[model samples]
Target chain A: MRLSSGDSIFYDLFTAAALNLRDGVRVLSEALAPDADRAALVPRLKDIEHAGDEHTHDIVRRVNSGAKTPFHRDDIYRLAGGIDDVLDDVEAALDLMVLYRIKEMPTGIAAVVDVLDRAADLTAEAMPRLRTANELTKYWIEINRLENEADQTYRRLLAHIFSGEYDALTVHKLKDVIEILESAVDGFERVANIVEQIALKQ
Target chain B: MRLSSGDSIFYDLFTAAALNLRDGVRVLSEALAPDADRAALVPRLKDIEHAGDEHTHDIVRRVNSGAKTPFHRDDIYRLAGGIDDVLDDVEAALDLMVLYRIKEMPTGIAAVVDVLDRAADLTAEAMPRLRTANELTKYWIEINRLENEADQTYRRLLAHIFSGEYDALTVHKLKDVIEILESAVDGFERVANIVEQIALKQ
Candidate 1:
């Protein structure tokens, strides 16, 4: 789909923001446990969260200021907020991983990371199609599929966590981590909700 | 606070929903472990959730119908959805309770119930005054205060859950319940976020 210069700019900016957030999750996932750079990880995670917030503001400011745009201003704003929420939850997982001094992120944690990564990817893929509302259906279906898959993955991961080598304290800490990751997918689900709602309106 | 006819109707419908859900929770809280009337209880709880979805549609339909409204329609829609999300979580919690044969409500569960009750009150309180932008801040503040209190209560309750309790299975079951209760506030917090965001626009 061809885009106006302004719309293209917003798309580029939002895509970059989404990529930063997804990349941040990648970094944290690789260093699931307390890393040697544990002290530095806090600020790194904060930077990721801050970038998410900044991108949120950037998107909203554009929506508020733009007289004309490709699609519903409100829909765009919601999509941006949904993407921002994913980062917030991912950063939250990182925060808990650090705060609890979790020595290791049990083997079960990867499912969440995988779900989040896929959700982020789905959102990234859906961005260019935002201006072409009809094409959103393809992306929307895939996003919905990923969110459903995330739900299954979350249920399995929780069962794994509970059935494994974690004590109550560890279970408590691990649940917090998994909850955040699961929540990121829920955030993605929220984005899917907004997209689906927008599609309904269209 | 003189009401438009539509606002009046919306208020009454929402009030009935709040009462039904509140009473439903009361029933679940008081019932015994084995004889909790699953057939009756499940559908009644579902009624609350279904009511919430209906209320969501009502708000959106009212907005779409060109009703003269005070606050942002989408914000109201989001706020209503958020409240419903809390009830949805509550219902989900009850499902898990029944599935797990959770016999007793923990002492800490009261805090979340209190929060849900207050959120209902706040939403009810906010509705009439929503036609008057002058009064939004107070309503917004109440939601924020309740949400903040819910957060602290959740932390304290979880800490207590970990520090106290019956056994590993008990802790496991209890922790799951506590998290569900706590995430209900997360739903309320989202409501508050939408409310505050709307307030900022005003």
Candidate 2:
């Protein structure tokens, strides 16, 4: 399906929102425990969120004005929505890191961060596939698999944290980070779910 | 606007799914501590996951086969997807608790759980409100406020955790759980995001 200018524009907005979130996570990771400027970083995170909202509005307005939608209205809306979920996951993580003043990433936490990066990559990679429903099937499968990997990682990380290796406070901090990262993965998994359903329809 | 029989059925499927996920969370809260009978409880939890999938399949089937959707095709799909998200969020929390062998709830974690419960309730209550998009707006607002509250509590919890009252492992463990629960609130927050967006379109 050749998406109309409106659909393409909407995707661009979604992609931009996702990239901002990805960048936000990267910023958090780059900062050392004491030097993390969450104040500076969080505003940028909210920018991505607001961008998502604005784009959602654009999509809906155009949708109502009788613009030609490339796919079913439901598909376009869900894709837009899945993008919001992805961004929220990232923003939420940044919020926790800065608010808690989480100084250092625990040993297992870095792994979850890696997982978030990979999932973000998948999300980025999946965008072009949305132009054609046929291409979506393979990307959809891969995203699902990546999400499964995230699940396994989340499980292993939780196990290690609870192994009583770290102190109680360390346990709390690391767990907060892990949970946020895992939710981001869940966001990716959800995108996969919507795509799979869309693929069947296509 | 009168809802079609198909629409009613579709909504019921999601209602059942949300209830299942909500119950799953309660089950997890009880089972999370070290004393949980994993041998029996794990299977039951797995059952909840399976049941959720079954509902997802049912939704997909109905969408694929049906011609006239009760509401807009997009609304039906969004409703279905949102319901799935509720389950996914709950399942992730439960799975992590079990995997980590987290014996008991950390103090901050309870606050996060309360937020999640509130969000879930908002979603459940808002479902019928879709019949009147105006009421849905109220649900949207409340859920957003709750997410904000959860956000505040989360930040406070993290600050306290980092305030250095506990040891390293305690910090680590509580951090993980609190973040998970926070993200769970964010999950409901995400749903609220969707409903609010929908209301905006209306």
Candidate 3:
């Protein structure tokens, strides 16, 4: 086992990245709220996404620098990349909402956003527990469950969007936002699956 | 060096999958034509997608069965999954077009579809060369270039869709189709990146 005590820093970086994702999702939830200042929140969410990139870069550099890692370096890279992908989606979702100048958000979007918040929370909680691989099973299982719930919410929302309540333009804007949110949820599931693979390989 | 002559079978499977992708893109191009009978083409594209899935499954089963592979098993899995993801997007794009009953595609769509066709060609051509990893750089480079072109075309189409020429419902439907097409291009880039990583590791 080449894992040295120093390798624990990787866990810290991952935790920071996951927590950054949680922050991004928080701002996303805020942006989705009616009467919220979405334009202002866009930059704030951008800052969180930038913070996530730094963590991802740090982890990538550490792995490439030939530092000792707790598990497969490939898994570490994938885990970091997966988390970054989610954050990117979250940021994009909010950016789209602001860009589209959407006057009204459709119904059922809140359910999907709530699912993202819960998924983010679970991911942040799972990051630190990655060090003890076996204990992370519950984390991933829950993420899978959350993702399933999110999928249902997403489909329902899609059906609602196309149900002719909003104008076509509004439906288009809302569809873009919700699709990105659903992708974020799916991204969390990918991250969790990576953790599970790491654990199983361990 | 656990590699044997039998390992060449993986390359064959990959090539078959790549060819399947080409078939998919051909059908997709037909479906995009102004005179296309898109409804009839849907099941045909779905058939291509199903074939791609079988190729992916075969590769996974072989890798999991402990067969000697040319590169990392994980990369093999990712390569297969990446190709599968592109096909999924292609099928979804057409599916959305059919479901939305989109009568007329925007002007710039043909350009974006052209880029996808070219990218698919490059990928199919590159797959057989995976055995000689050193020969694969040009493949990925061209893929990157094509993706850049596809990105620009996609953006222009988006601007056009929102340019107020089309009605709101038409804009929404066109946005959905073009976005998925762009994703298919991005998916090819990812697959190329994975192939590059495999070569570099080798």
Best by lDDT: 3
CAPRI accuracy category, model 1 = incorrect
lDDT at A64, model 2: 72
In angstroms, the error of model 2 at A5 is: 3.1
Q: After TM-score superposition, what is the CA distance of residue A70 in candidate 3 from its true location, in Å?
A: 3.1
TM-score of each candidate?
0.62, 0.55, 0.67
Best-to-worst ranking by TM-score: 3, 1, 2
Model 3 agreement with the true structure over B1-202: per-residue lDDT tens digits = 2233688989889989999999999999999999899999999999999999999999999999999988889899999999999999999999998999987787678898898899999999898788887569899999999998887677577656766688886786787788899999999999999998888787
Per-residue lDDT of B155 in model 2: 76
Docking class of 2: acceptable
Please give the lDDT score at residue B191 for candidate 2: 68
- Taking the candidates in order, what DockQ does each have? 0.14, 0.42, 0.24
Q: Which stretches of candidate 1 lie over 4 Å from their true place?
A: A1-4, A20-85, A91-111, A141-145, A163-165, A192-202, B1-12, B30-48, B65-79, B96-103, B106-202
Kept native contacts, as fractions per model, are 0.08, 0.92, 0.25
Regions of model 2 farther than 4 Å from truth? A1-14, A28-39, A64-66, B1-150, B161-202
**Model 1 per-residue lDDT tens digits across residues B1-202:** 2333744565554455455445555544543234456546777777767776776777777878887665666666666667677777777777666655566666666766777677666655555444344576776677778888888888887677677556675678777777887787677567656756766786
Q: What lDDT does candidate 1 reach at residue B199?
A: 61
How do the residues B66-145 of candidate 2 rate in per-residue lDDT, one tens digit apiece?
75544666766666676676666666666666676666655666666666666666677676565467577677778888
Top-TM-score structure, candidate number: 3
